[model samples]
Target: MEYSIEDVAAARSLQFAKYMYTSMATFWTYDYACSLHEEWTFLLRSHWSKMKGLYIATRYLPFILLITNLYMSFTPNENLVKCGMLVNITSGLGMILAICADCFFIIRTYVFWNKNKILLAAIVGTYLSFVVASVSIIVDTTASAAYATIPIPDITGCYQSSTSDQIFIPFVLFSVFGLGLMILTLIRAIHSWQRNQSHLYVVLMNHNILYYACVFLFSVMNIFTSLLLQDSYQTVLDGVQFLALAIIATRMHIHLWQTNQHLRGSSGLVHIRLSDMSSVNVTA
Candidate 1:
């Protein structure tokens, strides 16, 4: 049997999305496996705290999402309503996952600034603004996502008939937020360098800068793809981006905890203990 050009394109796009899911599953498996020992030793053995709760959520929520997304892409489902509902569920979860990952930056930066109230206020204010705006935009745009049953050759999943261009706004907001965080971190990084040139200080600085750079790059890539592409292609980077944020953020927390425990740090670095990092009083 023959198919129309549009049908062929749709099939190819769905195929590409399947490839994306395959890659995400592969990466997630490898990343989670490699970190299991660290998680058991550093996280499971540690005392509980609100910060630990956030880290656990950030680390594990994506595993739930990965399962759902796999079901969406690979499983045989033709109900448009179910497809739309799954999309909404995943999108909302992804937004929440993003905030969870971002909290690490907020907490770490607050600690990096030596828990200065003024700097903490500045960062928290900007972050809350971004959060409010992104929540409003994502809620509005997610409602606009429409799906249809794909009746074409070689396609097993429902096709995303339409998604709002405004969906890109959240990515844009996040990119801006990430850039600001990186800027603040770099500025403070200079002060840290001059204040105390300890090995612990160098390690912390290296982790922040390098990981922030990676997250920032992926954010930009997401913005462009979400803005320019349509249908399945629009979200090709979504899984990888989320995984990047999760893996990098968790690594930052774990490495810091281990460093603090082992080195006990010089005067410069010891003040920023892992337990105290997330105790920033945003209300004050």
Candidate 2:
């Protein structure tokens, strides 16, 4: 192979062009993920207040964090943007929601247990740890002010490495804790159903378990995909997560409505049957 100086220069230029194209593609996919996040957030917000306030808050908090993450990914002025503050607010609100849910579950479990203080305490303690971990993540993310000067390493965006590590550690811990809690809840529900077998209770409990399980599993998978795969893969993951959540939630909501209607009809029929029986006896 004979190559002139011009040929060497041409090859180098081609390689550079390819590298730039790849980088641009990754950035595009990353931006697309942010857009999807915003889209899903808006959809969920539109449905807010339909369920209890808890549902409204749970959907809102994560969407807000998704927005903050989107902003950080797009912005180049690391020192001028208050992105870290946004993250802090998002995580803090999320932690509050988690704690509230924890309290609600603890109370329900206590009532179901006939005020077993020990079991209640254990469950509460475990959830408290979850809340604490979330709060720690909030604190760490906040420690690195969005407007503060931070080193920008590569095209991945601006982040203070030291503080980010602290933030990530607590985030991982909280996620793990959440997964464990979901599993425990599922097990407890199964046992409760086996003991008494109330159809209504069982149905509700299973729906609740499935909802939490999807939340934990998909959320973890989304995070993992974002961290490990190329940015293109992230776009795919974002799409998958959004569609999965939407489909599952919608289905559950529809089924709940149907179940309620059926129950109401059954109750009415029972009332009519008792009335007819009483009327016949009076006639006799």
Candidate 3:
């Protein structure tokens, strides 16, 4: 039978949807793969640490998300769409990464402020609360029918949920975590600078500030765009958000290493100056 204008329009919409999914699949795969390689390389080369494990776990999340997006792009079956919905649930990995990094920050704070019990406990307690909230959202949203039942035109192709649920709790949790830890870190660094003028304090504080600032900004932007924009645009926003985070973290890491090296050189000069002063005083 011959098709009419309405049929042609419907066909065009499906084709457009397929193309959109295809683009998402391509970008996320590349973004996550690069992250996976970077995290794995860092884990293997660096000293064993909790932060490294956090990075490794984080590095795998995008890959898993891409897989779910891919399933949606390719699968047309309504029943299996539920399975794809489950995969989208795994995107909470990003939120988990934020929590893990915050925990590491708290531990670092404790180590640096070993003399201060109250501050350390507060940081630890706050991070734990965030972890609890994030877990709740991930569990509840992924299990709902709302995720799996979005209608598709045909029964023959892949259907996927375009995005995760609102899940505002995790975003709010991380934003607070980043902002609070950032302020705490700055205060401790200022205290260290006043007491000993240790350059390590400056270097570390700067890195921490930039790292979490990026996380905080990205989290907010992602939340706004995902909540307000079209589903098609959300995929692009996701990729951009991930890219910004990766760049910020990598740059901060390099900055810290360089700053530490410079500080060591400066410390050597101070030691030499003190040695010369002692000799002059002894000779006089």
Candidate 4:
């Protein structure tokens, strides 16, 4: 059997649509399950520190983006494709989520390092530089490009006409930051372990390493797939990566809180500081 060009395009659009819905559904289900868990009250009633606020933002932002993207996927609005507003909004939201997730790591690193003010300042400075560079790229690219609609007849949706190259810069910056944080965490964990030989430090070290590694891998793959394939499917991967980052960061935060609560209950004291390394407490 032979398929025509139109058939292929339709099939591709249909596949993309299916993937978007599936991913959105998965995010909602995971979020709902989290709410049902006993930790939900803890997450809500916990002290609203800066890090906690950022974590909460990360948790909700992706769901908002997913909902908007899903609507755009099926809205059949020709103008939505060319307006560039949606693209800008989506990109901005993604950047914000990335920043929040990275902030969580930075704070963790700072705490692991015993809340060194100098180290915290240096990390924040570096993070700010990346933010400026990313925003500059986004603004320049969006301003210069003439966005148009690529209508998919089969799916009744339209995609913005933009090259995947725009994603590379931000992703590369994020990947570098992630790798640096992972290294910092590993170093601190090792140092703490050598000093005290505590199992808690090992757990802290392992969790940070694993989360950073997973997120870094996702960032790298997003860049690779966008650069190499340059297809509609790449958009699906982008959605997945964004949602994954949000979920993982939020889960890490909740896990840390739960672990800290457990330690406090069992040991009669919580020595954990979000910006200091005094003992084997916790790092979320």
State which candidate has the highest lDDT.
1
Q: lDDT of all predictions, in order shown?
A: 0.75, 0.46, 0.53, 0.68
TM-score of each: 0.89, 0.51, 0.63, 0.84
Model 3 stretches with alpha carbons more than 4 Å out = 1-45, 80-85, 111-117, 145-166, 196-199, 230-247, 250-284
Question: If the candidates were sorted by their TM-score against the true structure, best first, what order would they fall in?
Answer: 1, 4, 3, 2
Which candidate tops TM-score? 1
Candidate 2 residue-pair clash tally: 2
* Better candidate by TM-score, 1 or 4: 1
Candidate 3 vs 4: which has more TM-score? 4
Candidate 4 per-residue C-alpha lDDT over 130-162 given as tens digits, one digit per residue, 9 for 90 to 100: 889889877776666453344444444444345
Q: Pick the winner on lDDT between candidates 1 and 2.
A: 1
RMSD of each: 3.9, 11.7, 8.4, 3.7
Instruction: Give a tens-digit lDDT track for model 1, residues 74-104.
Output: 7554777787787778777887888898887
**Candidate order, lDDT descending:** 1, 4, 3, 2
Against the hidden true structure, what lDDT does model 3 obtain? 0.53
- List, residue by residue over 31-99, the lDDT tens digit for candidate 3: 556666644554465555544555445445556555555555456545665554534553564454444
